[model samples]
Target: MADGERLASVTWLFGQPERDSVTEQAASPSQPTTADAPRGRHEPPTRAERASRAGEFQRINNVSMHALARRGMSVAEMRDYLIGREFDQHEADEECDRLLGVGLLDDFALAETLIRTLRQRKGLGRSGVTAELRRRRLENDAIEAALEDLDDDELARAIDLAERRAPQLRSLDTETATRRLSGFLMRKGYSSGVVRAAVDRALSRSGESSGPVFR
Candidate 1:
């Protein structure tokens, strides 16, 4: 009877493992007892999984390219677009090449589109459009080509721009107005010679002489 009682005591003490023992085994470095494995959180994705994600990335870039073209993107404009979206250089370059290859992007076409848009909407001249195209990183050949198409349109717009802004130009004294008009036209992308000619023409049309004569 004493031995059976001792056996019962042994069973109660050690036969079932303690929860603390299980926890210590789990906390042990060599073996992980639970699927949760509590140490390393958010492990990096495997190579195959990364490859799958890269494919999805390319697909999304393709869609974004078409969407940008729909909004009238030139080569430089597209570069700016990708930069704005925080695309890495490699991805942005690849997308640029793909779009250019597929005819969805062209620098000359973009320059022409800008010229037309600015002429109708903003009343800008050839020099103004040329400056803008250059700012957009268009090739010299492309800029020249776009400017060729604006010969008549640009001259007319220049005249209108000068006429419309004449009051402000004339508000200054004649010498001041000449200087101010020159600066203004220069800011609008006109050459110094062109600005001088335009200023002379405007003054003559207003019944003022070629020399500095106050109104």
Candidate 2:
């Protein structure tokens, strides 16, 4: 009977350890795993994040304004400048529209200003002015609208340009002078008719196209 009691006590002690181990494991807090993480979460921007974005946009706006002050920029140009400066595209577009609403960025106005500059300062005629406006990336509607303001003065401008350049051709033969003068005026964006008329009038005035005098 005493041997039987001893064996039973030893078994009970061994079983207590296993029971304790199981109880401790069950009572311990579980560590969160990836499977327990929040699914499809999207946190809203904090105040600091919002402030940082505002400051960034303000800097972009200032840069655009300074660029405009330095020289005229079309709406497309301002957007490109902002994007090139690493601003977000959507934000850049928003700022551009804001400026446009305030009349600070006007494609039509820019086109008009460019037209005046090319015509008066650079002596470019209608086609040349249009080409330059397109090069500046103005909208097509703005380009057409701005061009409407131009007076019917292409012929006069062409004549003036030809007269200025005709004196240089006095040394060349009449045929050579005519050819060169025509090319020059054509390159200046004058039409063929305008070029022909200007070349003829210029040569006649300079006596370069005179008939042979009788001996």
Candidate 3:
């Protein structure tokens, strides 16, 4: 085709005010585009809904506290238990504080009771009692206070444990008996010095010459 014919064809194809039409559409405020459209309103929770949620949290706290009370749980133990049960940390802490405030949870009392029970019934030494208290999440101060009562009688406690265990090992030879007794006391968390002395007294009473020496 001739250049003038081609130019006329092009002009006819795109010569209309397409840009002006788009500009007019964009400038018109009557029509709202996606960006200009109003957003859906969000409703806040009602007072009743908030109260229901709070009631649910209280119920959970009450159930947990009651169960722990039945078992005589310490504050830390209850908190850990509640957390393990999927309770919120802040909620668990609040519940534990309530229990503590009412004396339903007492770490010091728990520690003292456990110390006595471990020593008298379980044949646990001071170290053993401390470890048990720590495992129960008792504070160090509570543990120390409880242990203070054991300071004067810890040796006697170890001796009683050794004497009780000595008879069972009577059939073994002296070396074997001493070795077994020492190991038993050590596993019970006794200090090496205490174990040695207790083993000696126990073995002597049980007709053994002396306790086995351990490095």
Q: Among these predicted structures, which one has the highest lDDT? A: 2
How many clashes show up in model 1? 0
**Displacement of the residue 41 alpha carbon in candidate 3, Å:** 22
lDDT per model vs. reference: 0.72, 0.83, 0.81
Which pairs of residues collide in candidate 3? none
The lDDT-based order of candidates, best leading, equals 2, 3, 1
The regions of model 1 sitting more than 4 angstroms off are: 1-59, 62-71, 80-86, 152-156, 169-171, 207-214
TM-score of each: 0.58, 0.73, 0.68
Given candidate 1, what's the lDDT at residue 86?
80
TM-score of 1: 0.58
Q: Write the per-residue lDDT of candidate 1 for residues 1-215, one digit (tens) a residue.
A: 69999999998789467866888786888875577566456888879989998996787577666667477666766776776778777777778887889887888888888888877777665677777788878778888988887766444555566655666655467777767766776677666666777776665566644333346
1-215: candidate 2 lDDT, tens digit per residue: 69999999999989998999899886776845677776455877779989998998789878888898899898888899989988889989999999999999999888878878888877787888888888889999999999999888888888888788877766787888889989987887778998898878777776345432111
What tens-digit string does per-residue lDDT give for candidate 3 at 1-215? 99999999998779667877898898999989898886566866779979998997788767776786587777787888888888889878988888888888888998888877887788887778888999888888888888877756667878888987887886788888889989999888889999999988888775345532222
What is the Cα-based lDDT of residue 82 in candidate 2? 89
Model 2: per-residue Cα lDDT at residue 164: 82
Model 1 misses residue 4 by how many Å? 56
